[model samples]
Target: MSVFIEKKKRLSNDSISQLEDELEDNPLDYNKWIKLIKQVMVKDKEEQIRNVFTKYLDIFKLDGEQWCKYINFEIGKGDFKKVEELFAKCITTVDNVELFRLYVSYVRRVNDVITGGEKARSTVISAFEFSVNRVGIDVKSGELWNDYSEFLKSWTPSQSWEKQQKIDLIRKLYKKLLVIPTEKVESMWSTYTKWENEVNSSTASRFIADKSAEFMEARAWNIEWNNITDKSLSRKVLPYGLDDSDKDNRKEIEQQLQYWYKWIEFESRNNLNLKDDDLLNKRIEYVYKQAIVSLPFVPELWYRYNQFLMNGPSTEDSNSLNMNIDILSQGLILNPKSYLLSFQLSELYEKETNLAKANEVINNLVNKLIQDHSQIIKQIEEINDKSIVKTQNINGDADNMDEDDVNKPKPGYFLSEHDIKSLKDLKLTEKELSRNITLVYTKLMMTNKRSSGIKESRQIFKQAKKFANIGFELYVENALMEYYSDNKKTANKVFELGLKTYGTNGKYLLAYLDYLIMVNEIESIKVLFEVSITNLLKEIEDPEGVDDMDTPVWIKNENLEKINNHKYFIKRLIKKYGKFATKFLDLGIVTSLEKRFKKYFPEDDELELFRSRYSYDSIDLIKYDLGKSVKYIEQDTRGDIDQFFDYDDETFDKNKRRKLDLPSKPKETAVANQPVIETQNGFIGESIYNLLRILPSASYYGNVEDHVFNSKKLVELFNSLDDIRNQ
Candidate 1:
C-alpha cells in the first residue's frame, strides 16, 4: 500500500511539473492552470494552494470558480476573518448569487459558533445586510432571506430592550423581503407569519396592531403581483428562466401555468373571510380554466384543478365531485396516454366507496392497452411476412427480366422508381411500432395498481429491449422508472445501455447528463461530457445525406431538423460549461457552429448587430425621409444647366454682325429652310448674342449696349417671322 501511494504521489508530482512547464510556455491555458491548482489542493499545503490560486486569479480575475475555491479554502481553514476579507473582495469582484450565498452561509456559521456576543451579532447582521443589498432582486434570494431570519431568531438578548430591538430588525427584514417578486414569495410570507404568531402570543394587542399594518402591506403587494402578472400575460411576456429563443409554445404555456399556480397558492393562503374566500376561489377557477384551455393536454393542470374542487368548501357536494370527474374525463380524452389522470379517476372512484367502478376503470384501461399491444404485434408480423414475400417476388421478377426490360418505365405517377421506394420506406417500421406499443403498455402497467402491475411493467420493459429501433424516450422512461423504484444501479445500467446504443444522439446524452447532475455524479459527468462532445462533433461532421430526388420531403426535413438540433445542443453545452467546453472547440468547428446558430436561431436585433459588426457591412446612413428625385432628360435635350453671364453689352457693338450675306430673297436648299420661328416655350430661351459678344479686338465680351441691341434684334426678328407667317 505504501509503495502504491508513493507511485500515485510521484505521478501527481510529475503531472504538476508537466502542467507548470506547459503553463510557462502557454500561460493562458485555463485548463492547465486549473489542473495545477487542483494538484496543489490535493497536497493540502495551504500556502502552496493560496499561491497557485493567487497567481492564476491575478492573471484571470474574472474566473468565478477560482475565486469561489479560494474563499472556500479559507473557510475550510476556519479562519473567519480571512474568509470575511476574501468574501468582501470576491463580492466586489464577482456579481454572482453563489458568492453571496457562500458569504451568507459563512456568516451563519460564525454566528452559530459565537452565539449572542455583540461583535458576532454585529458581524452577522452586517453580512446579512450586505448580501441582501447585493442579491436581493435575484430569484433565489429567498434562501438568503430565510437564512437571515433564522440567524436573527437564534439571537438571545439578555435585556428586554435588546430583544425588542432584535424583533424590530427581524420584522423590518421580513417586510422588505415580502415585497420582492420572487418565486419563493409564499415561503417568505409563511415564515413571516410564523414569526408574527410567536410575537402575538407574547404581546397580544401590540403584535396584532403591528401585524395589521404588515398584513395590509402584504395585501397591497399581492395585488401588485396580480397586476404585474396580468400585464405580462396580456403582453405575452414569457415567464422568467424559460428560454424565449427556443420558440416552444408548449413550454411557454407551461411556464405560464407555473405562474398561475403560484398566484393561486398565494390567494388561497391569504384568504381571511367568506368574501375573500369567494374572490380567491373565483380567481383560482378563472386562472385554472385559462391554463387548461391553452394546455388541454397537460395532466398536472387537470390534477390540480380537480384537487382544488375536491378540497374547496363544495367538497361535500355531489355536484362538485361530478365537476371534478368531468374535468378529469376531459383531460383523459385530450391525453389518452396520461396514466396520471387515469389513476386519479380510479382513486376518486375508490374514495367514493365504488371499488367495482375503480377496478372497472383500471381493468378496462389494461385490457385496451393489452389488446392494442397484441394487435401491434400481429400487424408487425404481418408486415414482416408481406415484406419477405414482396422481396422474393421482386427478386424472381428481376431474375426473369432482362436489364433493358427491368429498366423500362413503369406505369405510375411522376415519381421515379427510387422515389417510390423511398416513399415506401418512410413509414415507421414494424420494429419501431412494436417498441412504441410496448412503451405504451409499460406506462399503463406502471400506473395500474393491480397485483401484477410491477411484474407486467418489467416484462414490457424486457420486451421493449428486444427491439433494436426503440426510441430514446423509451430508454429514458425505463431508466427513470428504475430510478424512481429505488433500483438506482439498474437505472444507471439502463442509462449506460442507452448511451452505448444512441451515443451519437444529443437527446439521450443530454437526458443522461441531467440524470447524472441530479444524482450528483461529478466524475461520471466529466466522463460523459468528454464522450458526448466527441460523438456530437463527429455527428455534426458526418450528417446523414438525403438525396433530393429519392428522399421523401418529410425525411429530408427531419434530417435537416436533426442537424439544427445538434447545433443547438452544442451551443447549449458551451453556454453551460464555458471554459470546460474548450476541448470541443476546434476553431473551424466553432466558427461553423456559430454561423449555423445565427442562421437557424438568430439573437435579437441589437445583439446580432453587436456580434456581426466585424462580419458584415453596417448601415452607416439610414434615410428617414424621401430621397432626392432622379432627373430624366430626353436624349436630344441638354441636361440641367445653370447659365452665368458677364454684363458687357458694349462688346456686341464693337463686333460687326457676321450676317450670312446670303441672297436677299428666299432660296431653296437641299435641307428645308424652315422659317426661323421661335416658340415661347416656358421662359423664352436667351439669345447667345445677347449673352456674349465679340469685341473689336477679336475677344468675346458682354456690355449693356450689346445686350440691348441683341434683345431688340431678337424682338424684331420674331415680329418679322410672325408677319410673314400670317401673310
Candidate 2:
C-alpha cells in the first residue's frame, strides 16, 4: 500500500493527431507521416490503427516498407482482410518497383492462407499486370508474375472456361514478356519454365517449351556469325594447323556435337512407341554410326553391332559375325593380354556346347601345371603302387574282384598328409580351374577305392572346405562323406567340434543343422536350439554387434532405446519358434519321449529307429502299446519264446478258431497244451529284437502314442488290459 511511483515518457500526441488528420484526407502521405504515427501508437492502440489503415487502403500510396509493416502486423493479428488491403496499397506505389513486387508477393502469400474467390484473384492479377509492364525492376520481379498467375488460376472458373481457354490464358501471359528485351527474357525464361512445369494441365509444358525456344532464339541468333567465328584473332598454330587461340572455339563446337549425340542416345534407348522393326533398325543404325564416328576402333560398339545383326533377320549372314570377330581379333592384337577378348572367344565356343575345343583350351592350361609338378606326379604314381599291393592282398587276385572293380581307382599311397596337400596346391600354382577340380574329386570318390584312404579323404575334405569358405554347394557333400565313414557317434563329435570352431556363422549354421538332422543327432540338435534362442534374445535386447538384419530370417528392431531398457526378450522367444513349439515343450511331450526311450530301450543300438520309416495312423499307437505290454510274456518262459516276442505284420489266429469249431476243450488239457518256452539270455535278446522289428519304427521314440492322437490309443489299450487282468 506504500506510494507507487511511476516514471512517464513524454509523447507529442498533438503533432501525431495533426499528421493523422492529413493522412485521413490523403492517406498516400505514407513516406512523410506513417513512421511518426507508428512511433506514437502504443501496443494497445494496434487495433484502432489497423481499423484506420483498412478504411484508407484505396487512398494510400504507402512506401513498400511502411505498407509491408502494416500487412505483417495485421497478419499477426489474424486480420487477413486488412493484410490484403495494405498489400494492394503497397504495390501501387510509383517508385521501388522491386519493393512493390516483394510486398505484393507477401500479400498474396497471406491471402492464399486466408482469402479466396474474386478478391484474391483480382489482387494477384493486378500485381501480374504491373510486373509485366514495369521497367528497371529487379530481375526476380518476373518471378512474382508467375506467383500471381498461379493465384489467379485457383479462382472458381467462369462457365466460359474451356480446356483450350485456360491454356491460352497462360500462353498469353507468358507471351507478353516473350517480346520483352532479350536479356530480361533470357533471365526470366528459367523461372517461367519452373512455373510451367508445376501446372498439371497437359498444354502447359508445350506452351512453355515454345515460349522458351522463342526467347533463346532471339538472344542467340541476334548476334552476327562473325562474332562467334572470328579466327583471325589467333596468335599461333599447332602442328595440326589449328589455331591455339581458336581452341576454345573448337571446344564449343565439340560440346554442341556431344549435346546432339546425347539426345540421339536418349531417343535410341527409350524407343517410346516406335514399331518393333523400326526401333530395331533405328537402334542398329545409331550404334553403327556411333562406332564409326567416335574412336572408330572401339570394341564394345563392334560387339553390339554384331549382336544386332545376328538377332535380326540377317542372323544367317555369316559375313557380319565374321566381321565382328575380325574387329575383335584386331583389337586383341593391339591389346594382347585382354581377358575380355579371350573370355568372349571361349564363351562363343561354349555356347555351341562344343566341349572338345573348350577342353582343348582348359587342357593347355592344366598341361602347364603337369609339366611344373612332374615330381609330384611321380610320387603320386608311386603311392598308387603301394595302395594296389595292400588292396590285392585283401581281395585275393585282382582279376576276380567285384564288378564295380573297374570304377575303383588304383589306390595311391599318400606316404604322408603333406603329399596330398602338395598335389592340391599344384592346380592353383599353374592357375588351372579350381571348381572343375572339385568336381573331379567328387567323381574320384564315387568311382575309386583310393578315395577310401583316410589321408586321401582328409585331403579332399580340406579342398572342399576351402571352396565352401567361398560359398560353394560342394561342402555339404564332403561333410556327408565324413559322416558316413565313422561310427555315428564319432561323426557327431567331429561335426560338433567343427561348429564350435566355426562360430556358428549363419551359412555354416544352416549347413551344420542340416547335417545333424540328417544323421539323427538329437543331443546336438537340442544344443543348437539353445544357442539360437540365446542369440535372438541378446540381439533383440542390446543389439550392439548383430550384423545384416536384412537377411530374410531376421526382422529389424525399431525403438532402440525402449528395446534396450526393457525386457522384451520373452516376446522374442515366443516369436522365434511360433506357438506350436512352445506348446510341445509346455505339455512335456518332448521330455516324456526322450526319457521313455532311454529307459525302456536302454541296450538297443538302433537309437535312430524312431526317425526312420515312421508312418502311422491314429490306431497304430494302441497296437504298439499292446505289443510293448505283452513283451514281458515271452521273457518268463523257457521254451523258444522267439515266436511270441518276434513281431511282424499282425496275423489272425486261424488254428484257434478251427479248434473252437471242432469241440470244447477241457481246462486241464488247455492249461497243459500251451507251447513250451525258452529262457537263454541270447535267445531272449533275439526274441526282443524280433518284437521290435514288427513294431513300426516310431515305437522306438515313444512317438507311437503321438501317432494315435497324443496317446489316446495308449489310454484305451491300458484300460482294456486292466479289465482282462481283473477278470
Candidate 3:
C-alpha cells in the first residue's frame, strides 16, 4: 500500500481502539460498538470482528439491531453451524419478530444449500414451531405466520407417505393460524384454499367438504375480528402488544376505529364479486352502528355514521333519511349541547323542506337560551344579595368596635373584599336578560311565520323597549327594521333613543351620522360628530367611570377598545370631512388628552399620530412683515452725509491757509448742494439695499407675497434708481 493508505489505515485503527475503550466503560453504547465493528470489518480483522460481535451481543442481547448484525455476520462467514447456533441464541435473548424471521430465513437457506434431507427439514420445522410459539398470539404477527406457511410449501418430501404427512402438517398449521385474530387472517384462508385445491385435485368429494368447512371458518374469523376490535374499543386500547403509556388513549381509540373501517373496506374491496352489494352495505352499516352504540358520546363517530348513511347505496331512499335523522337525534340526546348534532338535525329538516320541524327546533333552542339566561340572572341576584348582607355586617361590626379594632390590618381582607365586590358587580341585570329574551322571542315568532307584518314587528320592538329601557342593540335593531321598512321618521326616533341611551357607543353614533348624511342633513351630521368626539374623549379621559357598569375583569380591555374606537372614529372623520374636521381639534384639550393617553397608553401609535397631526405647528401659519420700514436707515444716511462733508483735497490744501476759513457763500453753497445730492442718492441706495436683503430672508415666513412678483418689482425699481443716479 502507498504511504498515505498506510497512514489512513493506522488512523482508523486508532479510532477503533478509542471507541473500544469507550465501549468498555459504557458497554450500553450500542451505536459506538456498531461503528467500531464497522471499522474493524474494513480492516478485514476476522477475529476482532467476532470478538466485537460477541461483546456487543452479550451486552445488548435484547437489542434487535445488534442480534441482526451478529446473525448477518455469521451467515456471511458461511458457517451453517455457527449461524444456527446464533439463531437459537438470538431467539432466546431477543423478543423481536424480525429476529425470528431472520432465524427462519437462515434455516431455509441452509435447507436449500446443504440439502440435509429430513434433518434440515426438521430444523426448519422446529424453527417455525419456535417462532409460532413465541409470536403467534400477537395480532401484528401475520408476517411470521406468512413466512412459516411459505417455508412449509417450499419444503418437498421424497416419499409419497411423507408428502401426505407434510401436507397434513401444513394444513394443521393453517388451521392453527386461522384461530389467531389478525388482519391477515383472510389472506391466510385464501392461501390455504389454494393449497388444498392443488393438493386434493383427485379427491373431489373430500376437497368440496374441506373447502366448505374453510369457508365457514373464514366467516367465523370475520366475526372474531369484529369481536376483537369491539373489545379493544371498549377497553379504549389496542387489541395486542403492550399498551403505550406515552400515546394518547383517544388516539388509540381512533386508531382502533380506523382498523375496523379498514377491515370493512378490505372486505368491500375483495368480496365485490362474491358478496351482494346490499349485503356488504348492511354489514358495513352494522359495524358502524355497533361502533356508535359503544362510543355514542364521540361526535366524530356520529359524523362518520352520518356520512356512511348519506353516501351508502340507500342514500336516496326514505328509510335512509329517517335513519340518519334517528342517528343524529340519538346523538343529540347523548350530548344535548353539541352544536354539530343540533345543526345536523336542522339541516336534515331543511333538506326535506320540513319547515314546521325546523321552526320547532329553532324554538327549542331559543327557549333553552332564555331558560339559561334566567338561571344566570337568578344566580347573580343571589350573589348580590349575599354581598349586600356581608357589607351590612361589616359596617355594623365596625360601628360597635374600637377604632384600633376597626383599623387593624387583617389577612386576606383585600382578597375577600375584592371577591365580594366582583360578585356584586359581575352580573347581567334584569334589563339585559329581558333584552336578549325579547330578541330571541321575536326571532322564534318570526321563524314560525306567525308574525310577518310591520305592525307585529313594531309591537315586538315596543315590548322589547318596555323590558329593556336602554338596551343599545334593541334600539339599533328596531331602527334597522324601521329603516328597512321605509318608516324613516320612526327610524330616526329609534336612532335618537339609542344615541341617548348609549352615547359612548361608536356603532350607534356612526349609524346615526350615516343616516343624517343620507338625508343631506349636514347640520345633524356635524352635531352627531361633535357629540361622538366629546363622548369618546370623555370616555378616554375617565375610563374608570366609563367602564364602571361593565365587568371589572374586562375593564382594562374595555378601556383599550374605547381608545381604539376613538382612533377609528377620528380617522373616519378625517377621511370623510378633511378640513371640516379641524374644527374638532382643540389644541389645549387635545394636548392634555395626548399627555394622558401617552402616560396610560404609550404604545398607541395611531393616537400619537392623530395628536401630532393636529398640534399647534401643524395648524399655525407664518407671516412675513417685509412691508415694515427699516430701523437703521436714518443712522446710515447720517454716516454717509458726514463722509461727504469730511472730503477736501488739493484745492482745499491751497485754501487751507488762504483765510483758514473760505468765504461764507462758497462754503455755505458747497454744504447746501452736497446735502441735497448725497441725501437723495443715499435714500435711493439704502432702499435698494434693504429690498435685496428682505428678498432673500423673506422665505423664512410661511406666506411671503409671490417671490417672482417681488423680485421683478425690486429689480425694476433698482434699475430706475441706478439710471437716475448715473444721469
Candidate 4:
C-alpha cells in the first residue's frame, strides 16, 4: 500500500508568501529562488522544491514561478497562447545569458513566440544594447571586435543557418579568396606552412582546414591560384591527399597533369619551335633517351618511340630501330615474360622470315595466356562452395544456428547433388577444352602454308581433330550440367560462362539447344544439328516438333517435317563413322571391300557391274562360287564356250536343257561338282582362277579361314597392283 501511494505524491505547500514579496521588489530575487529550487530538485528534495514554488506562487499573486510552470503545463495541454505568454514573461526576467538563451531556444522550439524568432532575437539585441550601454559593459559589441573573423563570418544569427543560402555564402567567400592578388596567395601559403611546422599551431591549422565552412573551395583556391609550379602544388596537396576518395576523378585529374607536364618538358627541350629540323631530331632523341632512362620497363612507350623514329627522315632512324630492339632485348632480359615486347620482337623477326623465332615467341604468348586462364579458373573454383547438407534456425539473430544451416545455405538455385558436382566438374573441364581447342586451331592454321611442312601440318591437323572430338565431348557434358533439370539458368549462362571458361568454342552452339528445349524454340534445322545426342533424345518425346524423326519423312509428313533435318544429320554422322571405321580396317585384319573386289575382278570390266554383284543386297550373286566363276572366266579365251557347263545338279540339268537344249556332255557333267578339275592332257591344276573361285565361295560359307586368309591376300595383291600402275 505504501509503494502504491508513494507513486501518486503531489505538491504540498509549506513555505510561505515572504519570498514572493522579496522577488517583486527585485527580479534578481526570483532568479535566486528558482536557483535554490533547482538545487533542491537535483538533490532529490523534490517535495521541498515543489512546496516552496507553490507557496511563493500564492503569495506573489502575480505568480512568478507559477507563470514559468504554466509554459510546461500549457505545452502539455497544447495550449499555444498560454505557452507564449509564460515564455515572454520568463525571457523578460531572464538576466543570466545562459538562462535567457535557454528561454529563447524554448520559445523557438515550440514556435510560439510573439513574432518570428529572428525578429524576436533582433528585438532582444536592441534591448540588450540599450541596457548594456546604460550599464557601460557591452558584451555583444566586445565580442564583435575579436581577432578571429572566421567564426563571426560563419556564425548564424537565426535558426535558418542550416539553409542552402548560408552554405552558398560560405562557398562564395572561399571562391572570392581565389581571386586575391598572387602575393596574398603566396603569403597564405607561407603562413600555412609556418603554422603547420609549429606543434601547437599545426593541429589548430589542420582543424581549421577541416572544420572551415568552405574547406573544399579553399583547397581549390590553393590549387587554382597558388599552385604555379608542380613541385609547389604537389607539396600543398600532400596534406590534402587528393586521391583520398574518388579514384576515377583523381585519375582524370592526374591524366591532365601528366599531359601538361609532358608538354612543358617537350617545349623546354625543343626551345618552343619545330622549325629547325636538327633541333627537332635532338628533341626526339632527348625524349627517347629520357623514356629509355626513366621508364626502362614500359614497352608501350618504347614501341611508340620506335614507331616515331621509323617515320622520321633522319638516317639515325635506322640506329633508333636498332636501339629500340636493344632496349627491348634489355627489358626482356629483366622481364622475360613480357608478352607485348616479345610479340613486337617476334614481328621484327618474322618480317625477316625468321619463323622459328616468331614461333618461339608465339608459343611463349600461348603459354602465358594459358597460365592466366588457369589462374582465373582456379580462382573461380576456390569461390564456389560444394558442400551438400546445411541446417538453419528460424530466428534471424540465431547465434546457435546449426552448422548444417551454414553449410547448406538457402540456395539461389535448385540443383541436386549430382547436378552440382556435374556443374563444378564442367567448369574445370572447360579450361581443358579451351586449351585443347586452341592447340587444334593453331594446328589447322599451320596447314594453310605451302611448304615441305604440309604433310607434317596435315598430321597436326589430324591430331587436332582427334583432340577436338574429345574436347567436344567434355563441352557437351558441361552444357548438360548447365542446362538440364532444376536451376536450368546454368544452361542459359553456359554461353558467356563457356566463353570465359573455354573461349570461343563451337561447342557452345551445341549447348544452347538445351535453352531451346525448355522454351520450345527448337524449330530451326541448324539448331538441331548442333545439339548433342542426349539433347536430341530429350526432344524425342515431342516427335512432331523436333528435326530427327525416328522414321523417314514420306511415311509421316508432320513427324518427318519435324525431324527432316535431324535424319539428314544422323545420316551424315553415320557416313562419318563409316569413313572412320575404314581407317581401323585399313590398319587392321579386315580388307576394305573395295580392295578385295578390285583384286579379283578384271580391270577391263566396268567396276560398277562387279560392285553391284558383290554388294550386300545381292546375296544370290554372292552365293555363286566366286573362285569358280573367276577360273571359268580366265579359261574362256573366246566369248561363248559350250564347254562352260555344270550338269551336276538336276536343277542345272533341267535349266540347261530348257535354255540351251544342249546334247549330253558327260565329261563336263563329271567335272562340274569336283573340287579340283583334271585336264584331258593329264595336267593336275591349281590355278589363280581356282584360288579366286574357292576362297570367296568358302568365305561365303562362313568358313572363317577363308575370311582370315583371302581378305589379307586380297589387300596385299591389290596394294601391289596399285604400286605397279603408279610406277
Candidate 5:
C-alpha cells in the first residue's frame, strides 16, 4: 500500500491513483467509489473489483441499486455463483423491493422454468414469497406486487384437486394484497374481483362481501397516501453529507423529513380509520420500518420507533423490549458511532434487567469511540492541509497567480457524502465527533452509575476528566450526582476542578453559578458570578468591544448567556441588593441584551410587578413603548451620516384631497343575513360578503389613482388586520 501510494505520487493525472487518493480521504463519497469501480473494471481485475464493491456496499447497505450493480457486474462476467451469493447478502441486509426483484430476475434467468424440474419452479415460487414477505408492505411497491401476482397466475395445474388448490392459493394471495393499504390496492381489487367472477359467480359474491371493509380501508389509504406522499421525495437512503450554507438543499432536506413525519402520523393516528388496534399498530410499525429503510442512519427515528414499541398501546413487555433492542441495534449498525442510538440500546437492555448486557452496550461504544477518536482527529488535521502554498501554474511565478481563485479547489472541494446522509446522517466533523465522544462517556458513566452505583460513577468521571478532551457536561453531571448523594463538599470540589478547566466557557460558568445558587453559597456565588462574567467576556475575541460589533448567532449566544447569568444572580440577590441589581441589570444593558432575543412573550408580568415594587421611573407608559420599539429605535442613533425615517402625523395623498363619504351600518340579525351564511346559532365566518350586499356601493367620486386604496374594501381589510393585532 505504501509503495502503491508512493508510485501514485509520481503520476499526477493517473485516474486510478487520484480516485483512490480521494477515496482514502473520504471513503463515503459514492461518486468517487463509482469512478474508482469504473476505472477498475477497465482492467478486469475481478478480486480488486470485488474488494471495491464490498467496501461500497458495506457503507451503503441500504442502497439496493448499488447491490444490483454489483450483482449485475458478476452476472455480466458469467459468474452465477457470485451473483447468487451477492443476492443472498443483499436480501438479508437490505429491505429493498428492487433488490428482491433483481434477485427474482436472477433466479428466473438461472433456472429456466421451461426445461428445468420442480426444483426450478419451487425456487421461483420461494423467491416471490421471500420478496413479498420482506418488502411487500412498501406502498410505492406497486410494480413488485403486480409482478408477483402475475408470476403466481402463470402457474396452472391440470389435476382437478391440484387446480382447486392453486385457485385457493391465488385467491388467498389476492385477498392479502387487496388489503395492504397501497395505491396498487385499487387495481388489485379490480383484478381480484375480475379473477373471482371468472372462476365462479357465487364464490366471487361471497369473497367480495367478506372483503368490503378491507377494500374500503384500502381506498381510504389510497386517498391519504396520495395527499401525504410527495412523489418528488427521493426514498433513496444514501450515506451522504451536506454544506450548511446551501439553504435550498437544507430546505429540501427538511421538507423530506416533514414528509416522513406525516407518513408516520398518518399510520399511528388511525388515519386509515381502522377498527382494530392491532392493525393500527402493524401499520404504524410498517411506516416506521419504511422510514428506517430510507433513513437508517437517523438515530432519532430509531429512538422514537423503539420508544413506540417499548410503551403505549404498541408495547408488549419482553417482546417490546427485545424489539427495541433489535431496532436500536440495527440503528447502531448503520450509525456506528451514534451516541444517542448506543445509549438507547443500552437503556433497553437495562430495562430488561440485563445489567451486564447494558454495561456491555455502553462500554462497547466508549471503546470504539476511543479507538477511532484519535485517528479521526488526525485525519481532520491532515484534511485541513496547513502546508498549502499558492503558486502560479506551470510558469512558477510567485506573485503572478491564476485569477480563478474562486474556482480553486480546497481540501474538501467535493461534497461530503456523509453530510448528505443528513445529508443529518452526514458524517460528523471532528468537533461534532468529540462532542459525541463526550456524550458517550456521559452515557457510560450513567450506565455504570445505574448498575454499579456512585463509587463507580465517580471513578468513571475521574477517568473522563483525565481524558480532558470532553466538554463541561462530564463535570456538571458528576458534580450533580455527588450533590444529590448528600456530598456537597465533594460536588463543590468537582465544580472547582472543572472551573479551572472551563472557566471561560459561558455554559460551564453558568452551570457552576447555578450550582452555587442551588447550595446558597452566597459569597462564592458573588465571586464566581464576577469571575464567570469576566472570563466569558474575555473569552469572546472582542478587543474592539462588543457594543459596535456585528453580533452573529454565536456572539448573541454568549451575550444571552451573560444576561441569563445576570438574571440568575439578580433573581437570587434582588431583595437584599436591589441597588446591585439596578447597577448590573441597568436599563441600557438589559435593553441591549433583550434586543438580541424575543420569545414573542404575551406580557411582561414580572417586569410590571418589579416596576410596581420600585419607583425607578414614573413614565411607565413611555418606558413600555421604548421597550417594545427598541428593535426599530436602535437601528441607528443620531450620527452625522446615519439615515432615519421622518414622518408627519398629517400625512396625506394630494390626489385624495377630498374625503370620500362612506355609509356605515350596524350588524343585522341572522334573519337579515344571506341564507347561505345563516344558521340556528348565528352567521358564520366574516359575514362581509353578505354585509357588502346589504350595505351597497357608491361610485367614482374620488381621483382614479386613489380609488383602490381609499375604497371600502381597503377599509375592511385594515379593520380585519387591526382585529388580528388586537387579538
Candidate 6:
C-alpha cells in the first residue's frame, strides 16, 4: 500500500527468446515467421532448427513464402533428400508461384546438361512441365512460363530425331502458353511468332495463323484482368498480423480482401455472360489459386473455392471430388479453428462412403476444439487474480481508467474463492465454439448411424457427453434420432438424461415438454415436472439482503430469469390446458398448473409498478443453424433408419461399439495413421512420408512419388555403379 518507487523489471534481450515470446502472443504473425526463421538460420543445430521450422509449417503449411524459405535452407545444406522430403510435405498443399520458381531452380541446380548430360536435361524439362501444369493458368505465373521457355531454347541436340523432337516440344509449349490469359502472354505470343518464322519459313505462316485467334482473345482478357486489378497488389498485401489497434492497416487488409473477392467474382462470370461453363470454371479455379496463395490464412476463401469446384460443371468430371477433398484439407491445415472446412470435408467423405475418414475429420475437429479450449482455460487460470478481478474483459489490463479518470484508483472489483467457478464451466462459456462442437457431435452420430446403425450412433452420443462444452442440442438430436427410429423407451430415456443435466435450461425443458405433449405422455410429463422443479427451487428466491454472498449480479439475475422462464412456460401450458386439469391446476391460488407459483411468486397488484419491467413472454429455444437436419436419416447401403440396429430389450452390446480415442492435431493423425507397407526387410511404414503424395497438391505433377537424385538409396546405387565402371 506504500507509495514507493517500483523497481523496473527487465525482459531477456535474446532474439530467439524475444521472437518466441511474441509468437506465443500471436502465432499467425507473418513477419514473426520470417524473423524467427532468419534468427534460427544462423544457428548450427540442424535438428533443432528443423523442429522449429516444422512447428510453424504445421500451422502455416500453405504459406508459399515460408515454404520457400525452408526449401532454400535445405538446398543450402546440400541435403537433397531432405529438400525433396520438405517439398513433398509442402508441394501437395501450397499452390504458390514463388515455391514453383524455387522448385525449378533446384531442378536446374542438381540436373544440368554440362555435367549430368541428356538425362539431366530431360529431368529439368520434366520439372518445368510439372511446375507449369499446376500454376501456368495463373495470371501471375508469367515468370515460370518464361523460365521454362528459356530452358527449352538453351538445349541443342546431336541427332536429327532430337532436333525434330525439340522443335515439336517448343511449338507445344508455346501453343499452350499463348492461349492462356496470363500477364505476359502477349509478349510470349510475339516471341513465339518470331521463333516460329525463324524455325521454318514455309510453315511459320500456318503455325502463326493457327493460334492467332486464340492469342488475340487471351491478350484482350489479360488487359481486362489488369483493369479489374488496378495496381494489382494481392502479393504485397500480407494479412494475419494486423491488430485492431493498427486501425489503418486493418482497414487496408479488409479492403484488400474485398478487392480479391471482387476479382474472384469477375473471374467466375458474375458480371460477364460467358456461355462456356468449362472455360468459366477454369478461370475461377485459377483466380482461387492466386487468392489462396496470397491469403492462405482466410478459411472463407478456401471454403468458397471448394463450393465453386463442387457445384461447377466440373462436378461431373471424375477428378472433381478429389479436387474438393484436397482443397478442403489444405484449408484445414491453415485454419484448423474454422468449423466450415471440417464439416464440408466430413460430409464429402460421407458422400463418398468413406465412413472412417468422415468420422476422422469430425474427430480431428473436436480434438482441435478440446486443445484450443484447454489453452483458453489455462490462460484464464494464469490471469485470474485472487482479490482483484477485471470487470470488463478478462484478458485485458486491470488499469481500465480513462485519461481523465486517473484519480480513480479502483479499476477492478473484488472476487472470492467461491465466486470464481463459472456457473457453467469456462469451456462451455464460448457459446459459438460450444454450438459447433455440438453440431460436430451430431454429424459424428449421423456418420456412425449411416455406417454401423443406431448402436454405433448411441456410442458416439456417449463419447460426445464426455465433453463438457457440447450444447444440449446433442441430447435433443440423439433423442430425435431414437424417436424417429420408433424406439419410444430409448428416446424418453435420452430426454430424461438431458433434463437431469440441463434441468433449469428453459430451451431444453420447453423442447422436452413439447415432445411429451406430442407423445400424449401425461404421467411421464408429471414426473418431469416433479424431478425438474426439485433442483430448480433452490435458486427460485431473489437475493437482496443476503450478506457475505459475493455472488455477481448476473448470476442472481440469471437465476431469477430461469424461475420466470418456468413461470412463463407454465403460463403457456395453462393457457393450452384447462385450469383444473390436475392437482397443480386445482389447488394453486395463482390459478395455474405451476405448483408453487402463488407461494414462491406471490401476486402483488400493489407492487406491480416496477421501475424496471421484468419484460417479455419469450422463452429462448436453443437452435444451432445446422445446414442439414439432424433428425432426417436417409437410406444407406445397410438399410433404412427404421430397420437399422433394432434392439429388443433396453440394451445393445456396449463392447461391440468402436471407441473414438482422443485425437492429436490433424497433421499428426495423418502421419500416424499411415499403414505399414510390407517389404523384403519385414513390414515398415515409411516414416518420411509427406502429404506431397496427396493428389491435390500438384494438379499437373501426376503421381511424382520421388526423384532418384533426391533419394539416398539411389545415391548409394549410383556410387556402386561408379565403382563398377572404375574397376
The clash count for each model shown is: 7, 10, 0, 13, 18, 1
Give each model a TM-score: 0.30, 0.21, 0.39, 0.26, 0.62, 0.63
Prediction 4 global C-alpha lDDT: 0.42
lDDT (C-alpha, whole model) for all candidates = 0.61, 0.45, 0.60, 0.42, 0.65, 0.68
Cα lDDT of model 2 by residue, 267-286, tens digit: 45532323566544654454
How many angstroms is residue 138 displaced in model 3 relative to the true structure, after the best TM-score fit? 21
Over 4 Å off in model 2, which ranges? 1-310, 314-348, 355-503, 511-727
Give the candidate number with the greatest TM-score.
6
Preferred candidate (lDDT higher): 1 or 4: 1
Clashing pairs in 3: none
Question: On lDDT, who's better, 4 or 5?
Answer: 5
Q: TM-score of model 5 relative to the true fold?
A: 0.62
Spell out the clash pairs found in candidate 6: 92-697
- How large is the C-alpha RMSD of every model relative to the true structure? 34.8, 36.0, 33.1, 39.0, 14.2, 24.3
Worst 10 residues of 5 by lDDT: 652-661
Q: By TM-score, highest first, what's the ranking? A: 6, 5, 3, 1, 4, 2
Off by over 4 Å in 6: 1-13, 17-31, 44-49, 77-94, 114-123, 152-173, 189-211, 231-233, 236-264, 270-283, 307-327, 349-357, 371-385, 388-436, 468-470, 523-727
For residues 65-123, what per-residue lDDT tens digits would candidate 3 score against the true structure? 56777778778888778877877676763456667788788767867525577787788
Model 4 misplaced stretches (Cα beyond 4 Å): 1-271, 274-278, 292-298, 314-321, 331-339, 380-727
**Which model scores highest in lDDT?**
6
The local distance difference test score of model 6 is 0.68
Please write out the lDDT profile of model 4 over residues 563-674, one tens digit for every residue: 5454333333323322333443242312343353344333633434333333332122332543222112234434455444432223332112212222343322222222
lDDT of candidate model 1 versus the reference = 0.61
Better of 2 and 4 by lDDT: 2
